[model samples]
Target: MIVRPLALCLTLLLAGAAAAGDIRIKDLVEFDGVRGNDLVGYGLVVGLNGTGDGLRNSPFTEEIMANILERLGVNVSGEQFRPRNVAAVLVTASLPPFARTGSRIDVTVSAIGDAKSLLGGTLVMTPLNAADGQIYAVAQGAVIAGGASAEGDGARVVQGVPTAGAIPAGAWVEREIAFDFAAMQQLRLALRSPDFTTAERIERAVNRAFGRSVARMEDAGTVVLDIAATGARSPAHALSRVENITVEPQRKARVVVDQRAGTIVMGADVRISRVAVSQGNLTLRIDERPLAVQPNPFSPGETVVVPRTDARLEEETGTGLAELAGGTSLSEVVAGLNALGVSPRDMIDILKSIKAAGALHAEFIVR
Candidate 1:
C-alpha cells in the first residue's frame, strides 16, 4: 500500500536529519508579479471537406465568408451563397511571462456555430484581445484537430471532439507587457501554503543565506524582502539566488473518506483518539404472489383475483464492541476493525458510526 511506504518515514522525521527537510524553492513561494496574460479572438476555419456549419442556421458564418471574399476582391453578394467549406470558431491562447513582439504561442480553437467538424481546416488571421478590448496578438495557421468524424445519409460516427482543435505556436505576440523584473528594489515572496511556522522557516532560511537579516515575514501568508540588502545587482539575479533554499513544512492533520466508492485518504499528520466501535447490518425482503379464481366453462360467471404477500427479516450481529486506547496507532485501528470480520466497504460504515459517536478523533469527511 502507498501508506506503508510512509511507515519508514518516521525514522527520517525522528532523526532530525537536515537533508530530509530539503524542498525546491519554486514549490514554496510565488513571485509577486510574474504572471501570464489571457488572449481570445473570433476567427473562421476553412477547407472543412463539406462538414462545416449550416449556412441557414449560422448566418454569421455566411457573413464572415462574404467579408473574407470581399477582402480578397471576390464579389459574392449578387450570387446565391451555399458554402460547405467554412466554420465560425473562437481562438484562445495565453501569452507567457516576458513575451516579446513576434514571439509565437499555442492556441486552442473551438467551434461557436453548428459546425459538424473542423478536421483539415485552416484558420484565417484573427486578432486576439485582452480584457481591456485591445488587440494583443494575431493567430493564423493550419488546424491540428484531435478528433475525426464521418457521416452518411442515415448514420454517423465520431471519435473524440471533432469541433475543437489546437495549433502549436500558431499566434504571434503583437505587444509586450511593460514590467521590469530585474530593477525592483523590494520583492515579495508569497507562500503557497501560508502557515506561520512555514513562513518563519523561510525567513530564517533566506536570512541565513546572506549571513544577515534580509527577509522578514509580513504576515501569516506573505514574506517581504529587500533586494539590495542581498548585495545582488539585479532582482532577477537576487531571486535566482534565493529561490533554491529549502525548508521543512508544517501540515494540518486531516482524514478524507468517500462513501460511494469505498475509498479512504489519510494525511501523514492525521491522528486518532482512543475509542470503542461495534458495527452490524440488518436486511428485510418482501415478495408477492397472485391468486385467481377461474369461471366454469360455458357458464356466465365472473372471474376473481386475490393477492398474497410474504416477508422475511434477517439480522446480522457482530461479536461485541472493540476497544482502542487513546493515541492508538493506525495499525491498531486497522486491527480492531478487522476483528469485526468486516471488509473495507463495511468498515467505512463502521467508521462513520464511530465518528458520529464522538469516539473517532480524526476529522471525518464524506463524499
Candidate 2:
C-alpha cells in the first residue's frame, strides 16, 4: 500500500457552533473584603519515625527544642545532644472570613530545615499569626504527610513530597477579626478576570435582579452596590439575593497553546480573517555504509575501511494553498485550521506565524 501525505480537507461541521448560556454572578466576581486571611507560624514537628531534622546541621531546631524542653521544666543547658525525633517546620493556614473564636480550621506544615520526612509526626503547639503579627489561632495535631519515604544502607526512594503535610481542622481560632459585615452601607463586587464588558454585565444583572438601580459600575473591575436599595436586613442578605443572578458574560477572542503538552485551546469568541495557508513536509535522509578494505591474503599492508554515505531529499506531494474565508464564528475558524491537515506542533507554528503577520484576530498566548 502507498502512503500518501495528508491533504487539506475542508470538513466544516455545523454542530461545532459555540454554546450560548449565562453564568451566575457569584462565579464571575469576588466579594470585596470578604475573603480569607493568610496566617503563618514557625513551629516544630515531633514524634517522627527517625526521619526528623539533623540537630547539628539545624541549630535553630536545637534551640527551639531546648526552649520547648525548658518550658516543660526539663533543663538541658550547656549539654550537647543529637536527636532525630523532631524537625522545625513552618505552619500555614488561611483564616476564613467571619471565622468565630473556637472555630476549627485546617493547617499545613512544611519542613523549614533539613528534615528528611514528616510522616507519622505531630506538630507542636504553634501560634498562627496574620500580617499584623498577632496570634489569631493555635494549631496542634498529628501530621498527615502526603508522601512516604524509605531507605536502606545503600539506596533510598521517595514518592510525592514527604517534607510537607496537613492536618484537617487542626487549628482553633482564638481571636476574631473585627469586621462589621451587617452594618455596611455599600458593597463592591470585584471581577476575578477584570473586563469592562463583564463588569458592566454584572452591574446590570444585579440591578435587574433587585428590580432597581442598586448596582453601578465603579470601574472596569468593580461594581458598587447600594446595600440599602435591596431592602435586606444586612449586606449578607443583599448579596445572597443577587448572587444567584445569571448574566451572559463577554469574553475577548483568545487562542492558548501549551507547546510542552501539544495542546491548543481557542475561545468561543475567536475568529479568523480570510487567509490562505499552505502546509507541506520536506524530508532529508542520510545513510552511511562503510566497507572494509583488506590486502591480498596475509599481506603486510594494514587493513582500512572506506566510508560511503547516501543522501536524498524528498518533498511530499499534494501540497497546495487552502483558502479560509473570513470566519464569523469560532467553529468556522476551527474548521479552517483543521483543513490545514497538519500536526498540532505544526499548527502551533502556523498560529505563531499568522500572529506575527497580524492575520490571527485573537490574543495568541503560548505556554
Give me the candidate number with maximum TM-score: 2
For 1-367, candidate 1 gives per-residue lDDT tens digits of 0122111111110111222356866688888887798999999999989988899999999998889889999998877888888999999999888899989999999999999888999999999998888898999999989888888999999999999999999999999888988778898899887889888888998999889999999997899889989998888888888888888876555557665565766554544566777665665667878799889999998989888877776665667777756544555555565676666666666667777777776767778
Off by over 4 Å in 1: 1-21, 150-155, 258-262, 284-293, 301-313, 324-351, 358-367
Q: Please provide, for model 2 over 1-367, each residue's C-alpha lDDT reduced to its tens digit, 9 standing for 90 to 100.
A: 1233332222222222385479898888899779999999999999998888998789999999999999999999999887898999999999999999999999999999999999999999999999999999999999999998999999999999999999999999999998888888999998888889889888888877888899999888899999998888888889998789998887777888776666778888777778888777766667889899999997689789999888877777755988878888887787787788776667877778778867888998888
Provide the TM-score for each candidate, comma-separated: 0.82, 0.88
Tell me the RMSD of model 1 versus the true structure.
Answer: 6.9
RMSD of each: 6.9, 4.3
Predicted structure 2: lDDT = 0.86
Which stretches of model 2 miss by more than 4 angstroms? 1-17, 282-318
Steric clash pairs (candidate 2): none
